[model samples]
Target: MRAFVLLCLLLPAFGQYEEMWGDKDYLWDTPGFTTTKPKHKACLYEKESCGCCLMKKQTHRMEAFFNLTHREMKKDLMLTKMYIDDMRASRSAFSFALDKNDSTECLGPFSDDAGIVFRHEFLNLGNNYNPMTGIFVAPRAGVYSFSYTISSDMKRAACAHLQVNGEIVSEIHGQDGQDSVDSDSVVKAIKLKAEDRVDVILPKGCIICSDKKFSNTFTGFLLYATV
Candidate 1:
């Protein structure tokens, strides 16, 4: 009986020791239990969230860059268009001359004649010069160079004036007495506004002679556009 009681006491002590240091006491080693630290899990979640935010920031930055580039490109395109338009406006030019060959059929010697319109087109670029009206209408505000020539028949003297907007700028006169042909030419530069008129005028009693060789000629060209 005594030996039986001693064995029972030893068995209870062994059971107590097992309960204090059993597998169940170690939660990490238990089935279905996580070994990850809470701080470590939180750090991983934060890192993943930050990565997503970084990607979004990069996407926004790229979009902004492209938008800026597109705006700049549009501005440049507008500027290019403006430049092309300016170049076209600056290309105004014209030249014309009389084609009358017979002195009897020549234009002029009229009462208050505004000058004979050349009625001929040698180089009417931009069509600014009107052959019928004998006038050049400035296409834009710019400096222009005008040149004209007048020829007189033998024993006859002819005089003409280059006029801008009805104001005289220069004049040409030719006189010959010995049965010889005489010619006079004049060149002048003037600043003009758009629609300003330029023409040659034959004062009363003035006569000009020309032949198929276009002895009486008028020419003008845009030096540079001011507008």
Candidate 2:
């Protein structure tokens, strides 16, 4: 019946049909096991390998926010260039004169905050000597407009006073003389904080200094702001 089903599939349930070809070179090149399932292999994110590590992590977070906004804009432009170089050295006009016995000194040693000093003796107006001595530390409380002078071309000029920690807020005894611009000894509208100590006394000797004024003026004081 079809040769008895091909001799019952070449026999061999424990029998043989020429001993199953006697090994046939061990089934020559054998490799056959199929159940139908292995087919994954996917990974291609594109753009040259996983998108170059996500564009280098978004370019390092945009270069760390542009290096912290360029270090706070360079410290606010160096405190506005030292407040515009102290207002261009106080307007700048340029002046100096004094010499009779000739004397000069400028002190703001209370611990200074915003002090300025400018002394020039042409020839010792009176000679007693006390040209200018200041001590202003306050730079944050309120009110502050202190001025002083003591000139002498010889018309009538001498006596100028001021104090802060000591109290005597203002004064100007011997009036009128040399006159650069001190009809009343400029010490207007004053108030302060942050340290507080403003003094400007010019016993009597037409104090003159112009280049505007504010190269630290010798300790008179400037830079007023900040609550």
Candidate 3:
């Protein structure tokens, strides 16, 4: 009975020490990582069970990294494409003189090497029925708008017609010995493909000046496009 009593007393003392040790050290060190909550950490235990905390943190970090990387990559690609397009449209303004009875025409394979003379594709503009003419062709595909004016200081009758693709598109005329410039007008904005054609057609009595070079002619019918 004495031995039994001594054994019970020793068991109580051991239990007390074990509880005290757990509270002081084992609770924090038993799992190889500190169990004490970080003061700055959110209540992760309230939102996620401890068993799942590590997996959730890893997944969230990976997703954030991927989103940042993808956005930067897209911005780089758009900038590169914009640079290439700007280089492709590098173009120069082109101009040429038109003659009173000369027909300027467009025939194939335009060159950007300068000194451009459009080849005549039709003979009707030079026909005797049409004494004055001018024409221009698009050097590249783009939006285009045109303005035209037919003028005369001489007292003679004239008629001017602007045509796109063989159709009469705009016209201005002075008849019965009138000396004046045609009212200025603009063509509807056109979206032309490369090599599209435009022409000016004038009847035999378009402009009249004593100087043979300026007599019964068309003047200042200009066509151009955004390069």
Candidate 4:
């Protein structure tokens, strides 16, 4: 009688500490984990009950350990991949001039604002700038540097505006009535988001004097990436 009493007491204690699904326990106070109260541990009625319970306890412990370790490893791998992808992000820089040859071209005194489509490519590292559109669409979110030079014929006005997303950011203007060309430039650093558009605009009444010497030009580069 004493041995049976001890087994009953010890089995309940073992279940409370070792089992994932326990009766009337803090983890399973609701009916979701269990449907009925346990009748008996069956150690006395069945020959293999105690052994099976012990084996189940060991198996549960191993499965829990393995699941936790696997989850931690997967989280670590995802973070490492994000870091590597950021390191390999593309670098952007482009420089262009108004004319490809020494011959002068009177590039505009339009009725409306005109975009300067560059004719010469000095450097284009990432192909982010489109010569056809006279626009530089940022590939990565970051601070960037933009510069422009406007050189105009003696009788015409030399002027250009730097615009981001159709909003004017800066301008370069110089004009001379004498028989000589005039020029001006402005450099600016601004933060931008990916796919943001940047361009040079020539006002309706201004003109740019262009030649092989890159007298009229626009340039830009990525200072750093923010995203």
Q: Which candidate number would show the highest TM-score if scored against the true structure?
A: 1
Give the alpha carbon lDDT tens digit for every residue of 1-227 in model 1: 45435544554434434443343332433456554646534422343344343333334444555677799999999999999987976687787777655433455677885566887677887889888888889999989999988876645667799998899889776654655666788989999999999999987777777787788888999998885
Model 4: residues with Cα > 4 Å off, grouped in runs:
1-85
For model 1, what is the alpha-carbon lDDT of residue 14?
46
Q: By the lDDT metric, which is better: model 1 or model 3? A: 1
Residues 1-227, candidate 4, lDDT per residue (tens digit)? Answer: 45445545555444534546343223233435443445464422343355554454544555666687799999999999988786566688999987666688787789999998885899987899999899999998999999988887657668889999999999876655654777888999999999999999999888887777778788999998895
* TM-score of candidate 1 against the unseen true structure: 0.72
List per-prediction Cα lDDT, in the order shown: 0.72, 0.41, 0.42, 0.77
Local error of candidate 1 at residue 129 (angstroms): 1.5
Ranking by lDDT: 4, 1, 3, 2
Model 1 residue runs over 4 Å out of place are: 1-45, 49-52, 100-105, 176-179
TM-score of every candidate: 0.72, 0.26, 0.39, 0.62
Error of 2 at 162 (Å): 10
lDDT of 4 at 209: 73
lDDT of 2 by residue, 33-59 (tens): 233323331112222233333233333
Instruction: For candidate 3, write residues 1-227 as lDDT tens digits.
Output: 45435544554434533432333221223445545566445334223343244333333444555676799999999999997775444331222223334332221122321111212222222121122334555556666555444444444443456666667677766664443432233344566666666655554434422222323222222134344
In model 2, the runs with Cα more than 4 Å from the true position are 1-48, 60-64, 78-84, 87-98, 102-119, 122-227
Taking all chains together, the TM-score of candidate 3 against the true structure is: 0.39
lDDT of 4 at 205: 84
Query: Pairs clashing in candidate 4?
Result: none
